[model samples]
Target: MSCATLFPRLLGDVGGTNARFGWQAAPGQALQNIRVLACADHAGIDLAIEHYLHSEGLDRPRAACLGIACPVTGDSVRMTNHHWAFSVQALQQQLGLQALRVINDFTALALSLPDLPADSKIPVGGPLRGAEQAPVALIGPGTGLGVSGLLPSQGQWLPMAGEGGHVTLAARTALEFETLQVLQHRFGHVSAERVLSGQGLEDLHAALRCVRGDTAPQQPLDAAGITRLALQQGESSCLQTLDMFAVFLGRVAGDLALTLGARGGLFIGGGIVPRLLGWFEHSGFRREFEDKGRYGVYLAEVPVWVIHTEHSPALWGAARALDQLH
Candidate 1:
């Protein structure tokens, strides 16, 4: 089957909090009928897709592709943050589609990297010296920390789908070490997600308060509350939390860049970082990203860009994957 035969394909990016749907009416055509629905409102993925199609008054697509938040290792898919679980084949059959592709959300994001428009991204640090053929790294903190990379091979971008976010975090300073120790004691394993994600923001704030011998509030602040207080209200503890979060994110991103030798560049995505753009520019993020002592010069040449595209790149990527299926 060719892309021509797969007209009116369904494309989706299903995150932990929301699910975005789009339609591709023809080959090489732009997506249409883009819609976002809260994940909580639907009992399962099928219902959400059904509701989207019904609400849009669109016909059932012959082919579909979804960039899902969970790993797509097998037929069974269980979201890490939500309660949705189903077999890919079963759902494909239920949707009455000729083909269905399910891929990691970060993989979809990575796949869309090459096609990202310049206006959609804002550079953070380093010179614009991206190698034409080198790998590109991607790291983002959203409902969870997502990590992936795009390796150029045979003139095609291959997306990695590793669980790099769950890797154990490293601390560089005494204060950072103390905070990690506190988290380790509570969570047993202190992955980067423990300090970089939304819930992680709350955890870091609460832990910093404990480490500083500050009075503990009866209840901890949520991620949004902390961000609001830090950005808008100028709360001391919230400010500290945001600073620490940016620094930690820098370290993790640098580590990934080194691991992948991402000389092409490193791109930051997800729902959180874009909101703190102004603060992130002045934070220790760039300093720590280039703080790799011996390799500081090497990293200094590698640029970092934060993706700020209004449209969903995951949807574009899923559409790309569906195109490849032909």
Candidate 2:
């Protein structure tokens, strides 16, 4: 079925690993359909859409908004890690969508911050701002790292759309510098995403293994698998991995907070953080976030939170983006 023939416009959050789809049956209403279609499963966007629709018993949607992990430039969107590429206008015409919107996944997540339900988030450190002037920062890691900020303006929040995650991942300690050196050998131009994400955690484990004189596993381990091992209560190596991931995330989060002046506070989101909530709060994340030189006190005052919403945020962000059309 073509998108023109479907009712209840579809909204999607297409990331490096999964493509989440849903429908806005009415204004401000989010009807979700979690489709675990790997990008590697389909040949292209159209085929993926068809598979999702057939599996969900839906026809083509009219107005659609797709939140992709890659930067949305011009009419073409080619994913960085996934082998998927498509022309927006051409796909809209092919699907018969009246209107189609494409936005970066992180940007969409940032847009959904203001409307996030209280139950969806858990405060990590300090209190959030009561005033509307403060800016909020969103940082997440999954297939890659994502960063964005939102500032209050014109009676609503305005989200910043930039590639802040790809910026240099700074190290303030000798051990961290060593980790950077190890990673630099594997991936030449290392970014924050290289060290602060799931893949980074695995890499950290591999390096730690090397440092401990144990051969690292040749087969790759998924993010959840590593996190589970760490959270199991008796595995020292996994615990070390989790601890390092948290501390480094704290350092990076602090960097993002300083860069954006996120007085409203910082948020931790992504596929991994929520699962390690306990470890994160008890780990060096909060302390490291406030470890800046003279500005330590200033950063200490800024609050940080972890998003616990299990419904997924990028989808809500896509819906929020769609609401902006009015």
Candidate 3:
């Protein structure tokens, strides 16, 4: 079947915590029946898709596309932060789909960058413009950190996907180094995601207590709860945790920009940063991002935009991928 003519296509963006799905009927039609499903509510991807389709009262789709929060190297896909594992070919057969395409969730997000409207993106800080032709970098923190980039070629954008979030973390201060030591004891290899994700916020809060010799066994807090404590009660430890989080994010994003020379722009996506809102715009994230000494000036020219939307824009990205598929 020709890709463009495929109707009732299923578009999805599967994250560690949530799976967002949309239905597109015919070409150039706005996605309908957009829904967000908790990953834990369903047993696996197939069940989740079935539940979505059932609830929407939609028929079987001819083609389906997904942006999953894991490596889609071959037919076998094992989620990095969840237990759901399946073969892509098997899934296509089970759904009786004529075609099914899957790619890294962040890669799909990258594909949607150029098409993103100006208002949908909130500029955090930096010069107002970026080099139009340079690579555009993207990194975001959610259940795990996601990293990807878009390389401009022949007036077209090509998305690059990799597990850049698993890269070794770098520490900038004596306190940060000490914190890493504490984290090392708790988790053997502290990757960037260890200190930059949702769980990372909670773990960092506890690790900070250990570093400060706070022997008082306080109740554990999740990311939202921790942020509540910081925002509502001005808890000192919680405050510091968020502070360090922004700084670490900046440094990591800076490293990405430097590596890709992403002067076109650097986009921040995912569930965490946008919630930070005002605090994030004023946080050390930007400072640490440009703290690369001699290279600070270069980074200063790289524009940074934070993606915010009530629904998953990745669904549109999946739709675009389907259109591109031959």
lDDT score for candidate 1 against the true structure: 0.91
List model 1 lDDT by residue over 1-326, tens digit each. 76546868999988888899999988778889999999999999999999999999999899999998888899999999899999999999999989999999999889899999988888999886598899999999998899999999999998999889899999889999999998999999999988889889999998998899988555779999999999998999899999999999999999999999999999999889998988888889999999999999989989999999777898998888776776
Worst 10 residues of 3 by lDDT: 1-10
Clashing residue pairs, candidate 1? Answer: none
Model 3 C-alpha lDDT per residue in residues 1-326, reported as the tens digit of each score: 56777888999999999999999998878999999999999999999999999999999999999999998999999999998899999999999999999999999999999888888899988877678788999999999999999999998888998999999888979999999999998899999999999999999989888899999867888999988888788888999999999999999999999999999989999999998887889999999999999999999989899999888888888888888888
The reply for model 2, stretches above 4 Å from the true place, is 1-7, 32-34, 128-131, 216-220
* Decreasing TM-score order of the candidates: 3, 1, 2
TM-score of 1: 0.97
- Which candidate number maximizes TM-score? 3
* Reference-based TM-score of each model: 0.97, 0.92, 0.98
| lDDT (CA) per prediction | 0.91, 0.79, 0.92
Model 2 residue 29 CA deviation (Å) reads 3.1
- RMSD, every candidate, angstroms: 1.2, 3.1, 0.9
Better of 1 and 3 by TM-score: 3
lDDT of 2 by residue, 1-326 (tens): 44333346777878888887776665645575666677878898889888888888886677888888888878998986688999998999988878788999888888888877888778777665533578888899888888898988877888887777788887677767777778788889878888777777888877766666777456765677788877875478778777777788888899889888888888877787888876678888998888889989888888888888756677777766766764
Task: Specify the poorest-scoring 10-residue window by lDDT in model 1.
Answer: 1-10
